[model samples]
Target chain A: MAEAAGYDPLGAAGTWRHQRAKLVVYTLLCLFALYYVLPLGVVILNSFRDLPDINRNGLIGLPHSFSLNYWSLAWDKFCVGGTCAGIEPFFFNSVSMVVPATIISTAVGAVNGYVLAKWRFTGSEVLFGLMTLGVFMPGQMVLLPWARVLGWLGLTNTTSGLVLIHCVQGLSFTTLFCRNYYVNIPDDLIKAARIDGAGFWRIFRKIVLPLSPPILIVTVIWQFTNIWNEFLFAVIFSSGTHQPITAALIALSAGGTSVHQYNVESAAVLIAALPPLLVYVFGGRYFLRGLTQGALK
Target chain B: MAVEPVTLTSVKAAPNHGRMLRERLATILPQLVLAPSLFATLIYVFVFCGWTIWISLSNSSLLPDYSISGFHHYVELWSNRRWTIAYTNLFLFTSLYVIGATAIGLLLAILIDQRVRAEALWRTIYLYPLAVSFVVTGTVWRWLLSPSTGVERVVHQLGWASFKFDWLVQREMAIYTVVITGIWQASGFVMALFLAGLRSIDPDLVKAAQIDGASMPRIYRRIILPAIGPIFISVLVVLLQFAIKTFDLVIALTGGGPGIATTVPAIYVYDLMFQRGQMAEGAAAAIMILLALSLVLVPYTIWKNWRERREAARG
Candidate 1:
């Protein structure tokens, strides 16, 4: 195959035909990339540019003025809904809600995955199938019940309530991810551990836990981004100070202000997006791994 | 060696009893660890679904009333103008969004699969939108699509005064705006999936096809795409589900506005239950969304299972 004329296995031989194909390919890819990056770039630039500059440049042009004030204002001074305390509180609300929810859901899911993959009690497969049904469940179906549940628990309109809701809702996905990953671990290793007098927790601690960091990271990133970005629940269950950044961004954008504060709102939107964006940039490999596993399975 | 047999047996039995107890604990531990999640899923999935279903059947309003009202809300929901429009819009949005995203995604994936330079950078750019919340995506897009400050204004300022991209505010065109933003947000995800599918195709097949003088497009169409047929279905099902549950995007993008022109079933549900205090009707609408999702998902799941079973049996 390598000896054949004009048959480049590595695809690096720059025949005229190959060069033109590469040109077309790069052109299309760059065009699509521009479409994807345009909004983000506009937002990023507008976030730092003055409102007057944005007004003059119509949001798609080079910045005439730049300042860090909008970031600060969006952080602590600008009003969202009725509060002048800015998006700071709501950002913290997302943080607090996401952190515990991610940890609890991931921990519980890790154990559930371990049991479902390794323990294999009778009917466990059925149980897992039923649990995974939660993944496909629309949030609308559970809104009324969740509202009532939260009310009964006296946790309505609180971040704790949102955390509880997320942890429960997130379990199915986390469990599915971890279980799928854990199923690939050879059974002989577990059997060997069992023969060595290792029990359930011991085997998990010594065998499974060490091999879990990859899936664990994937699950954490998945759950973190998801819970942070969750809107329907945040909007429905919480209000005002307790709302996450997603909900607050809505209020801020639609705050019925006569004039849109493009700069500050832009900064606020970026603030809301920063966490997941950072996660995606850093753990992109695991993020995509999670997405594929979470979607296809 | 001279020890009594009774003492030896007693010691052995004691250790055996302890070992049995330990074994019992080990057997139960997994169940114990697993029970909470199972219970939670049972409540969250089955019970919550049942609860909503019940509410949809009841005449609940202002607050939940347990009294069975016998599908009155479902009837009312079907008759409602907003609900009808919402669902009709959902169908349109779902079809367009799914097709558009999948087509664009397949193209991008194929393009990237040419072993493009800076593949990671390009993939990151395309897929980054999935990282941001829909609220953020919608907000940025809403800005860009707004006539006053968005593309229209920029084009108008740039020596072209007749440019009109006011779909965001137009009553009839608002839904298309949602579809566009959705495709923008989701196509990357589909692309990622397709790229994976493309990469997973056996190299020899392509090599053989090339040796047979098959062109690239022909090779992709006849060989690579057919190989990734399962991925196409997966992407379709996933995108359909996304379109069905689309609330945040619509809320942030158009707020189901231009006078309910863009009202999706999700926005309708939220409006009915939270804003209008029509809880029963809202629950009914919510069920409709679920039904729509299952309509796409059930067939997919069955086919997947059947395919797996056939493969297993063959193997």
Candidate 2:
């Protein structure tokens, strides 16, 4: 009836209006994209511009000359003593910490999810409840006591300390995901296995593990992203020698470095973003599938 | 019930051993699978959290001995003006950020759900910030808001001299700068959550509303919003948890400086232990945070479990 009044919901005027609205939304989203991507853009664009270019050109300008000087500067010269200690070492440090942390937590969480889902127990729910609690505790509360414990155990300021901290922090959410997803599995399969004289570990290893491909992927991606970019615990547990790139980048933020270091900063920033961005783009479908399965509850 | 009984072969398995061993393995395997998580949880809670609580009661420093000093630390934390200021700022910070982030994120989610084009592109736009670590973002935003050599400078040069984009320098506004930076980084996560929630609404409800001659806004208000209530609760809990732990941005942007104007509880604890050499005071503040977190989290856990259990029983 509305269309009959020559409103032309599908005609030129209607089409024009719809197209204009779409263009407007698209423009706004593009602007939002800029807002979201600026830190990265700034870092990447500036990475190529050298010291004088950074100084003369200001932050928003197209560089008159591009150089790898600042990446070299960050790598070789940014240290207090001017040793040209490039970001390469920190890159290796981060990879080492994040990989072990991600694997341990995700593996543990997968096992946890399988058990909680497939088995009945007197106190399983209580254990699950505690896992959730550990997930939310602020990092600050744990740092001091953690320092003492680390000092006592002689792991204080080591890669293992950072890994332990990240793993502990990552556990609660991973467990939550595993538990929620495992709950969605059927009971009959477990019963059938039990009837066949399979034990709990065997059934979990064979049945529940195979059935958990989607969630396990999600858990790995989430933990991997989280630990890769984790800053606070990295800062607290690491010092000059064993620092992750995040801790290294943090120096630029604390200032007294250079006001015109925007390009250098942008380049360094881009480097930090590379790991997770690659994960999302390459494995985006798996990423979203993981997100939906883990977070939808 | 039929399977719950042991059969003649089960009797032989139980008595003769081979099958009984298999049965025991079946039952115990789940527990074994549970061991690593249980071990991690115990260490996390008992070792980490327990030590945190112990330190909170004492006069321990950077190198704490764990020896008790009664409630002196807690008393100092309560009376100290700086600590009080930090707590007040954090309270206001968390409250405003959580509420604003959720409201804006949900609005964006709704707007995006209106059959817009290039949805994946839009989502990436919003979510790309999450990929930027706090280290880079806090500095970039700080530079953007800088009084002299930043975006503000460019705008001023374009003949907007009256414009003072210096919230970061002003003591009163410094905390707000951190808040803005935080929301910019985090609102994307909330948007993603709301987007997922929005996607799950039954199409039939929307069609039903449309057939009744209800307007789009009315449909959303009455039908759409309610369907997403449970998700709203999830976003709320996650947001609240996030708000409680905000630290990185403030540290990066202001370092809790300009006279500690932007100081928050987490920063305060970090300052005491790492920077100020006030280990006991830091410990006390950590306790206060735990107490505050529990004040919300414990009740929340209980309420959620009760609701879930009630729903299960009803089902």
Docking quality (DockQ) for each candidate: 0.57, 0.40
TM-score of chain A of 2: 0.85
Q: Give the alpha carbon lDDT tens digit for every residue of A92-180 in model 2.
A: 88999989999998888777777777675889888887677776677777887677677888988889988888887788878888888
The global Cα lDDT (0 to 1) of model 1 is: 0.90
Q: What does the lDDT read for residue B310 in candidate 2?
A: 97
Best by TM-score: 1
Error of 2 at B209 (Å): 3.9
**lDDT computed for candidate 2:** 0.74
Residue ranges of candidate 2 with Cα displaced over 4 Å: A1-27, A72-83, A255-260, A285-297, B1-29, B65-67, B211-213
DockQ for candidate 1, please give it.
0.57
